[model samples]
Target: MACNITKLPLFRSISSRSFASAANPKPIGGVCDYEVENSTVNGVLVTSAENNSPITRVSIVYRAGSRQESSDNQGVSHVLRLCAGLTTKSASQFMITRNIQQVGASLHCTLDRETISYTLEGTRKAVEQVLPFLSTVATEHTFRPWEVADIVGRLRLELATRPPQFRTVDLLHKAAYRTGLGNSLFIAKYNIGKIGPETLQHFVNCNLTADKATVVGLGVDHKELTYIVEKIKFPELAGQPINPSPYKGGEIRCDKGGDLAYVAIAGEGAGHNNMKEAAACAVLQKIFGTGSSVPYALDHGMLRSSIKVTDSFAISGLNANYADTGLVGAMFVAPSNVAGQITENVVDILKNGKVTDEWVSKGKNQLKAAVLLASENGKSVVRKLGQTGALTGSGISPNQYINLVESVSTQDVNNVLQKLGRNLSISSFGNLTCVPYLADLK
Candidate 1:
């Protein structure tokens, strides 16, 4: 649960009022500020907030990511994100890293399908000291030639050793959308090797821009943070807004090598703002994959599986909620021969939505219990808040989301299952021999 942001000591004694001023007034956007400041940094919306503590956490979020790239530039956002952590023209990465460490501060960046973020955390004093460096890395990193070579070498090694991690998701996306922004994760090995300094530079210049960025600083003084934000500038980018082309979901199949077959079945679900439908989908997924205590035979039996749970093969249900789209998926690693049987069994469980009141009640109770556990940590709280704000442009407390989950009825779960049955996308990775069994599911 350790996030990309750092923790510093200087924030032990600050008050929210430290940032209340005319120069940095409340934001004008609708429902944009949630214990934070919402402003436009070079035409990109930014959010900042203050806690009683003296620490300030700054995060720069952008809408650019793997989903924004063309087929030829599959991993461009990921490469660019790593490059953002490297040395800039005005300073060495080591010197800046050491300086921030001296003040008990840290910085990190993460790239996902829809967004990339840069986070900085430290005490007020350390944050103030490191803000300019953060700004420089954010807007002025040169992506030097030697550094690009070094990163590319490392990336190649990673791809070679860990191709499955990238390939699994990449293939899943391709399976879902045959063409458009979603189906372009696989860039040929030759193309990956050919990514040069110029390629990285062009990627950074074209994809990263103020128009698609959001800056969020939490637990800080708004006036001071606004002043710091105002000083940061980047060259204006001229182009049409990056609109992800529409996707029409379909099946995708591929073969690699392994004794067991790995399968992922997904379907379109509600977005973050569709609270009711989203909650229903969550309950539906839990009923199908949630652990035994629910009185569901399938979940109880799966929990009782004699197969030794390897650290890598822990089975779980996944619900990924995006701004515009969401995915509800279940993954299982089973013997190659039984892979088809498992998929069919799972699909049958989803189609035959038979949940008693006890099962529904238990699922709700389980979800509520987990939320209570997550609230004890400051980092989890901050992350949950940030993610909700980023996705929905609104804030919902943990209790609120739990309430929604608890309110989902058996009828709701059945409705979601019926909806899912109509639209399904499945992906299998392993030996080609296992693929025949999986392909028979449709």
Candidate 2:
């Protein structure tokens, strides 16, 4: 049963009750009571929200990512993000971890294709005390010589332990873009020794700038949070300025190891603001690749002998939609012998295109259910809000998402499929033995 926090008078009076109930109940679909304040920290866009709740979350998102790096600096952005937690002006990595544990908080950073986010979550009281430390790390981290060497050593260890096939994904991106937004992963086994303290420091200095930053805060009193934010100071942003842009699409393929061939075909689709098109693209993915209950199967009849083919592979398809551009693709991991046939069949399905009214309705319902489930947690809510605010400069309510999904129709799905069918970029990652068949997609 869904707990209606909005309907309860007790919850209305006690802000903490709303957070306590959020874990189990579906999120309330209305405007958040918190007020947002926007400012610039030496040109960085900082957004903060104040609420009466005890827990608070602070996130700093930057535009610098793997996509932004030049070929020579392919992995620098990722490396910088990882090293952000290691050394700060006020504390060492050990002290930061200890302090966070004592306060029941956590600090971490994540790097994606287009963005790097540093996040901290804890009690409001704790966060108020901790914000300065976080700011120092964000704005003034010092990459010591010893720490740089240690980080490189650890990265080398990871590369040695990981399988060769795993690296092919990075290679695929490198080949596809060939330039902007298509660089290699940081800390490759082949490149660890090449990176040193000077290069890492240069990377940090060049990429960590106000022009590329976005700060988001949730669950703290807005007035108090605003005060804290206003008091903090940052040096003037340096380096070349960055503006948001969409990723251009092109083919990228890699041949590595294993008896089976893995293929991922992708194309540019829609953005967050294009709700109808995004929903349509999702429905297109469901009808073509999602084997769940829809009973769609790969051409080679599951290819049981292939190592990459698991129960999960049968239902897998890529439906990643972003703020500026999106990727819609289908992948199949099948035996080397049948890999060509599977790719052809998958393409055939895309070309034949059968998006009926029933299929459209089912996809919409499934997508809505998934969104509802994801929005139930307070952390998830904050993350969603942060992404929306950062990417679109607007906040979306849960009800708005539901309404948008429900509004999609069969014609929209068919339209999306028709567009994807005509223009597509396919990528494959696997063995050299499987390379010949990949050219067939062209």
Candidate 3:
């Protein structure tokens, strides 16, 4: 029986409430609630959000990701990410871990195609205790050869456990952009030993510059963070700017032995600068749905429902926004024999898909809910603030962002769908005979 929650919040309660009244009601992101400040400490950019929480999150985000790496230095960024919190010039790896644990703080590193971040989360006092340590981790690192060797072994194991779908998206980027954004986040097995400490150091010296890095703090005082940031010195970005690589539509296939095939079909969509289009693409993603929200079930989205059988298959929408370009499409995983049928159906739906007012409204509401929920998490807010600063030099409130999503009409979604199909790029792995080619998609 369907529960009637007409009067409750669409997301918080199990309701079939109409979103027309709620749509564009107010700005929902709430990032603007905090007093945001931006300053340059000795050439390093610092963006802070004084959220007034006892706990604080400090992140050092740099533009030195895979996109900055060249053919010779491939996988250097991955190695650098592993080296975070390791031995620095003034501290040993053991000492670093012990100190953070003693202070009851959490420290970790995260990387994407365009950026790498090292974050520390704890009480304000604990964060203060580790600011200098984080600075060392971000800049004054001593990449010893033995430590680099150890990290390489761990990276190989990490790469091995990833599902074939993850590798497929990596290949999709390679086919879409060829290089730059095309570079894979996971290092190739052969490049493991090849990425030495010297190469990592060179990559750091050239990319981790004061100009390319941002120190972002959430739930911390702006003045205090600025004072701490002023004392740390970082190398300048001495490398020449990387040339822009446009999206070159194509396909890449790997015949890894497996019973199921993993496929991702995509084309250029919206860049980060075009947030309206990005938001529209996100609504499309939610409308298409990604697999199932419930365990042992499948979504009723167009692609999922169109499939006659699914015990052997899984498919989802793929929408990713980047600094200058984006990818919008679908991913499919199915038994080798049935993969072709599933892929064909999904592509057909995407090419000629129709978006209704109901789907658009639901998608906007869901996207708004996700943005609000992420804001409730301190770490997520920190990352959001950092990304805003890095990309747009400012932040938007959750409420404002919600309105952006709410404003996406069915027409916007249809336009984005048409754009995605205009120039398709297909990436397939595992069993090959069942996945469709770019020509087949056309």
**Each candidate's clash count:** 3, 5, 10
lDDT of 1 by residue, 1-442 (tens): 1124332212122233333331332232112223545555557565655544444567766666667677566667656765765777566767666666878888877666666677777665666666666776766658777777777665666557654534655666676665444644334566665666777677667766776666676666556665655656754795225555443556656777777677777667666768888887776566445555545343542222433333333345656666666766666666666666566756555445466676677656766776766654434545555565565654465667776887798888667667666667777777546444434554
Rate residue 415 of model 1 by lDDT. 70
Tell me the spans in candidate 3 whose CA falls farther than 4 Å from its real position. 1-39, 237-239, 291-297, 310-312
lDDT values for all models: 0.60, 0.58, 0.75
Residue pairs whose backbone atoms clash in candidate 1: 11-54, 11-55, 37-48
Give a tens-digit lDDT track for model 2, residues 320-437. 5666666666766666666665666666656555666766776777777667766545566666666666566655656677788788888887777676666565666765464444
Distance from true location, Cα of 44 in model 2, Å: 4.6
Q: Residue 106 in candidate 2 has what lDDT?
A: 66
- Point to the candidate with the largest TM-score: 3
lDDT by residue (tens digit), candidate 3, 191-280: 878988888888888877777778888776676677666667777655446547689989999998779889898878887789899999
The alpha-carbon lDDT assigned to residue 266 of candidate 1 equals 69
Q: What's the CA RMSD of model 2 in angstroms?
A: 7.9
Which residue pairs in model 3 clash with each other? Answer: 27-399, 27-400, 28-398, 28-399, 28-400, 29-397, 29-398, 29-399, 30-397, 30-398
